[model samples]
Target: MKDNAPVFDALDLDRHAFFFDFDGTLAEFTDDPADVALDARLGLDLMRLLRRTGGAVAILTGRHRAEILSHIDPAIPVAGLHGAEFPGEVLAHDPARRAQFSPLLPGLSALVAAFPGTLLEEKDAGFALHWRRAPQHEQAMIAAAERALTELGPDWVIQHGKFVAELRQSGGDKGSALRRFMAEPPFAGRLPVAFGDDLNDMPMLAAARELGGLAVAMGERDLPADHRLSGPRALAEWLERGLA
Candidate 1:
């Protein structure tokens, strides 16, 4: 993590809403996703601070709500499944997208099974094949996934991340989730601040910036962020400052 001050002012805290990406932004990344954990005391402090400031906070993550919920305090609002699902809101996207792509899964499964080293993760609307444990074939698997996605057509979008490649419905992303949140109560009419790390978080960072808010990029790997911090500890420290 870098120790540079982000170009943000304390005055912007008034009536602000905060949205955060889970994995890298809120917790340290782990080889096994299940190993990620939150700092319970810090999380409580931040949540309390946001509530006291008349601001709302939410988590926008690529993981399933259940997976994310297991890592963070349950009280926070969450948009999960990469915006495919929201808290208490039925998914607006068509479930049939998965069905349409079902035919391709067999081939994908066969390919992965033969690889012997990759880990296959199946979601309701997408699939992610992780090659973190099998560095030798990471690039090959990514290329295969890309080709499969291209052959599968525009309905499917292939997203690449650290040691993983995912195929999901093209329309659902963190930007969509943030936009949807901004349109609703508790989140609307407030400064929109988002913190994230990774290429997948680029849209949310852009959205926050476009909305006249601050976008803080977390971790060492860079994309585009209004402010860049080294890791979650720095983020927690920044939040403790209250923009004041």
Candidate 2:
């Protein structure tokens, strides 16, 4: 994340709804995603923003609700695994889906073993093959993911990102999550302002624009973003300043 000013000017952020992506947009990236943590200062600022927004702020993350709750307090609304609300149940838990996914797990695990530089991020609903530290192995990782997807059939899809390939449940995307939030309590009836940094967040960005709102890109990557923030530190500062 680099230092850049937000592009959307003169907009009253407090008056609109806010949705955030945690990994790259809010938290600093770590080699292991599990090692990522929210800065307490930002956490407090987030609490303030939540209050400022009339409880319309939400986190739409790939990580499960349990993981998010451990890091962020005040239990803000969240949608984990695409659009599934937290503490409810992830669609990946469906017995039939699990049965279909089980056959491909061994192959993916083998790929992880072969690519020591790559990491296998197992989730309750899906899995991700991360090669952030091993960018050179991108091609190899994609090939492995392809093989698994081919075997797993149409129920799975791969989300490509910076140094990573995520195999997830088909049709479960950020756009769906954002739409779900917009149709629900608090989030409903407000202009959605989303912030994110990767391919996974693109859908939500597009969705925000569609819903007559805005999308703030975390860094300078290609996406349907209306504004840009320098980095996670900048986001924290923006929120902290709002406390005044």
Candidate 3:
């Protein structure tokens, strides 16, 4: 959260489509994921941005769409489970994919059970093992994710975040989601502006730049971006400036 990143100019609401990452970008990190909350003021700001941009705002998150809704307004469009879930698009491989993951659940549960502070989060395409409450178990969680990947075969991969490791299907990511969103109404024909704070967000950031738009890095992840801000507070202030 160092303030080393310079502030950039306000976005032109009419021409730019905004894509945001939730945790570590819009909201601060929490020991317990269930305790994470979206700031009411930021939610209102997002609603205003949506209005100003002709609804060109969306969230691309690792959380499930339903789970994300518990924190934010359901009116805002969200591509959840790292884009595995989209608005009204039923994935043909969903059931098959879920079945593949079902068998691994018992083993994963047993793994976390050995680590008192670790938690398992099941998602549409896969699952995540969080070690935030038990940093000492980080390596074990990662190894577990790697082992799960082997069992799931080439179609699956491991995604490492701040204090968590996830095992999910390969291909469906924030970048793909961004590209898909850019092809649709309200998002099409506009420059993409992505904001993120971690390794998992690199694809989305790269996509924004590849699409001839801005990539804003939040926090100190050393991410390649056109602009950067310290963290969520800085982002909130930056959004306020854009609104002004």
Candidate 4:
């Protein structure tokens, strides 16, 4: 672990831009993604954080726009689908790309059928096979992803998370999301502070630290984050202490 500082103190040094990952960061992960909900205390803490940052907060998640908004309910801009700039829909560039990826879902779904506890999830620009409930089948799940990618073409890439392997469309990531946000009003000229708990989040974390702000790892992971917190509860408590 590197030398970490109080987040509030870091924000106090200059104008700060806040970016957060949804699952495993703001909220705990659930077997069923639909079962996940934003904690009320998080809402309150976010409300306070927003007031302090002057509305420079955003959610950078792998979820779709509707799914993320329905939970967090923050009026602030969100970059979902790994920074797809979901306005009206999650896809920012081409609508047909989603359709292109849709046909591949059934194949991926079938690939996970042999594993009883695995799940096949389709996202706006991609799909995933989660094996959190079936840890023993991880290698098989990964093999399935590799086989799917061989047929899916080079337009997609495989990413890993806690017991989950995913395939998201090319061209965008959380780092690009943060960069785009940094170029906009309220966020421009401000230092960025990012938080996340997965490997895919590394780009955004590096982006934040590179921009001279801060990156925080929400859970235990070997990553570069100026600060670290045990979990969402610890994060909330830290925010409260800052406000106090």
lDDT (C-alpha, whole model) for all candidates: 0.79, 0.80, 0.88, 0.81
Candidate 2 residue pairs in clash (backbone atoms < 3 Å): 4-230
List TM-scores for all candidates, in order. 0.87, 0.91, 0.93, 0.91
Better of 1 and 2 by lDDT: 2
Give the TM-score comparing model 4 with the true structure, all chains together. Answer: 0.91
Could you say which candidate leads in TM-score? 3
Residue 40's C-alpha lDDT in candidate 3?
84
Clash totals in order: 2, 1, 0, 0
Tens-digit lDDT string for candidate 3 (1-244): 4564433355677899999999999999998888888888898899888998999999999988877888878878999888988988764567988998899999899999999899999877788999999999988998888888888899888898999998888888899999999999999999999999998999999999999898989998999998888888888887777677
Give me the runs in candidate 3 sitting further than 4 Å from their true place: 1-10, 91-93
Q: What is the Cα-based TM-score of model 2?
A: 0.91
Model 2 per-residue lDDT tens digits across residues 1-244: 4444453344465557889999888898888887898999998888887887778888998877778888887467778776654535544456776677677778778888887878888776667899877888889999988887887788789888777787777877888888887887777888898999888899999999999998888866767677788668888888776566
Clashes of 4: 0
For candidate 2, the 10 contiguous residues with the lowest summed lDDT are 1-10
- Model 2 misplaced regions, further than 4 Å: 1-9, 85-92
Error of 4 at 37 (Å): 1.8
Cα deviation of 156 in candidate 3 (Å)?
Answer: 0.8
Better of 1 and 3 by lDDT: 3
Clashes (candidate 3) = 0
Tell me which residue pairs clash in candidate 3: none
